[model samples]
Target: MKYPKIRELKEAIVSLLTPAYTSKFPAEPHVPFEKFRGKPSVDDENCVGCETCANVCPSHAITFTDDKEKGIRTIIRDYGKCIFCGQCEEHCITKKGVILSDKIYDMAVFDRSKSIEYQEKELLICQSCNAIITTREHLHFMHRKLGPKAFSSILNLNILNQKLRLAEGQDVSVEIKDGLKRKDMFNIICPNCLRVILVKYLSKGV
Candidate 1:
């Protein structure tokens, strides 16, 4: 019948058509939408290690174990549990996109622990003035806030080098000893305090 012939013709045409979907695993990677939620990358220099991301994470994928005495904060990410919800990125206060990075879609490995890697180095604090000197991001942020002139006036080889320089035989180190402590002081002292500090230091010829 005519119906049988039409069905046979359709099937023949279908055989000539290309496959609808294909995976880009080995040769190429698939592109995600611009807003796609992926892995979180910390700009440790910018990150004060506030542990805000860890506290806000619904999945508990982020962990921060800070040693206040040492002024060291360790950040750990569990990729396996991360929902990629972008909560961390949203909460970061730094304007430099601290929690920003693309997810490796094809990042599969035998050991799950290896998938999580630490991107930041140990945040070394200034032992003398309790200022953040090691992190380029922190220094950049400070410079931006104070302006170039003030930055140069306040920070020179002498001041910069003295950040971690402790007065020998002192009972207690002069450094802040923790990012949280610095942040607390930061809350109390805004741009006004910075201006005042710069003016005072410049007048004293420090």
Candidate 2:
């Protein structure tokens, strides 16, 4: 109650009355670092199918298969066992860039077996012809690259038709003749085949 005893009691009381300094997590959110690892992404348009990412990955979380004849490749990413090493992103062939996201960190699940790898469908791309035969959008993309004048050439049209017929069968046609007055019907090949036809025509000098 006096001198040293009084001072010690007062100090203890004051400390107990002071506000808590530690974080109240549920009441207040915690902030993470700027480069937090979230989900991974791939810009398919830029991906050259090099498989460099799969080769360098320490965890073997990435897999890529190449189609030599078509010159197209497929990639699959397994995020379950991913170590967030950033090695894949570093080795990616895309010059634009690849980076981790801040969204999917809590994606872990109780089913370990099911969490292994999710397969994604890949597009079959032609290296030399640059044809996207699988989907219509890819066909349009190829056509856009080839442009109009080259697109309309008769030889190119016939060649394109031949390829389409070979792949889609002879029943499919893309030919059209005459105008609004005297309409005619015909079969036509897709745009990719058209370009190939043009190349053949030029070589023949016909």
Per-prediction TM-score to the true structure, in the order listed: 0.52, 0.40
Clashing pairs in 2: 156-194, 160-193, 161-189, 173-187, 173-188, 174-187, 174-188, 175-186, 175-187, 175-188
- List, residue by residue over 1-206, the lDDT tens digit for candidate 1: 99999999999899779574666656777665675666666665567555567788899888866454565666788877788788888886575445546554555568999767554434435444444334434454555566656435433323343444532343333443333232222221233434555566645766
Each prediction's whole-model lDDT (CA): 0.56, 0.53
Each prediction's Cα RMSD? 8.6, 11.2
The residue ranges of model 1 lying beyond 4 angstroms of the native Cα positions read 1-16, 68-71, 102-104, 119-171, 174-206
Per model, how many backbone clashes are there?
A: 1, 10
Best by lDDT: 1
Which model scores highest in TM-score? 1
Clashes of 1: 1
Model 2, stretches more than 4 Å misplaced? Answer: 1-31, 65-74, 96-98, 113-206
